[model samples]
Target: MGRTRDRLKKAIAQSRIPSSHGIRYANELLALGAWFREHAEGVPAFARNRDLYAHVNEEVLGDAPIDLFEFGVREGSTISKWMEVNSNPASRFFGFDSFEGLPESWRGGVGETPAGSFATGGAVPRLDDERVHFVAGLFQETLSAFLTQDYRPTGNRRVLHCDADLYSSTLFVLATMHPWLDPGSVIVFDEFDSPLHEFRAFVDYTSSYRRRFRAIARTGPLLARLAVEILE
Candidate 1:
């Protein structure tokens, strides 16, 4: 009887029929492909760093002092890139990270990312410039305090660079930054297509707050830039 059952299970495994999860994943991919097809021209145009930099430069007011924040500053590469492209001398850059990778697993247990996957051993990189600053520790521990006390109003033109890859982390950061996000603020997501993480978080946040944000530019399906129109 045991041998017969094992053979039956093996046959099922070898069959062409896919599991429920497989079907769902296929459907989701199809939907994503359809979306890409609909937004074809813009996807390729803004996929490169130079193009994104050009768009940001045009979007921001040249005379205003820039207030830029990066959520996941891994080895300080992107921050450096931003500083390099920015011609405004008064622009201030803030990079936030635990330097110890993700605080928890993303998308429950199904997702492959493990906790502490991007850990940097708490070693913050030196940007050398006095205009740039690094905030160490998890977002939950440092974000609120930074907003309340340390973050002085420089200019209305602000840019938030989100690299943290998890629904919880993204949601928390959005909610915490809500009050400060006014008109002309740009939020860039580095991993926007992680459906269970960034995509879901953005949808839930916008719906809950009734905020009106437009996707001004995108660097392929992975990276997207949204311009805020919030009043308060």
Candidate 2:
């Protein structure tokens, strides 16, 4: 009976939802979400966070290859989970980290954690996945190198996931990636809901722009800091 129930649960998770995502990548997202939840047990309690990243990515679907840059990837877990679920042959996932740990200081005041406290000692678990790319060193330095030398996009269909933990690095990415952005570009703030970091960065980005945007939420509390926003 327990086995039967498990099979039924798996069946439900594997089921694809109806979406305007077209055929290929649309169905892939549903499956990837299921796989991430199933096989990757004993993982950190970051599924919900990654799900938020994936959900917003789904809303900004395109037939062209998917290009993504993740500010912080502790180990390649989230991207691996994402690849398992979506399994996009064309999609490319990039993660940027100090690898050695957090930066020196976060400039403005942040939350409970100190500026350098979150450092992981630069030892992110390595994985050999074709879809994933790992960028080591400070984002401020590595990012510009990538745009000119390493990264070449098709339609430049990109998703920027900023988990840099501080405003300086976060704002730096926004400035550099701004020119590459098209109407389809999607930016994910891992801590966008935070009172100090992301919100402050968003204010700076919006301060100069005259155009307004529509917001979409897939889960959690609708308040700004409590949830992630989809600006369209």
Candidate 1 root-mean-square deviation in Å? 8.2
Each prediction's TM-score versus the true structure: 0.78, 0.67
Q: Which candidate achieves the best TM-score against the true structure?
A: 1
Per-residue lDDT for 1-232 in model 2, tens only? 2332343355345545332322323233234334333422222222365565455555545334678777777666656665654556888888888876567554221114545655677776577777788888888889899989998776546766677766677778777877676555666566553334564565466455422333333223322211223344
Quantify all predictions' global Cα lDDT against the true fold: 0.70, 0.57
The Cα error of candidate 1 at residue 210, in Å, is: 0.8
Q: Relative to the unseen true structure, what is the C-alpha lDDT of residue 208 in candidate 1, on a scale of 0 to 100?
A: 93
Q: Worst lDDT window (10 residues) for model 2? A: 218-227
lDDT by residue (187-209, candidate 1, tens digit) is 77777655556756776787798
Error of 2 at 86 (Å): 3.0
Q: Which stretches in model 1 have alpha-carbon errors above 4 Å?
A: 1-44, 60-64, 107-111, 221-232
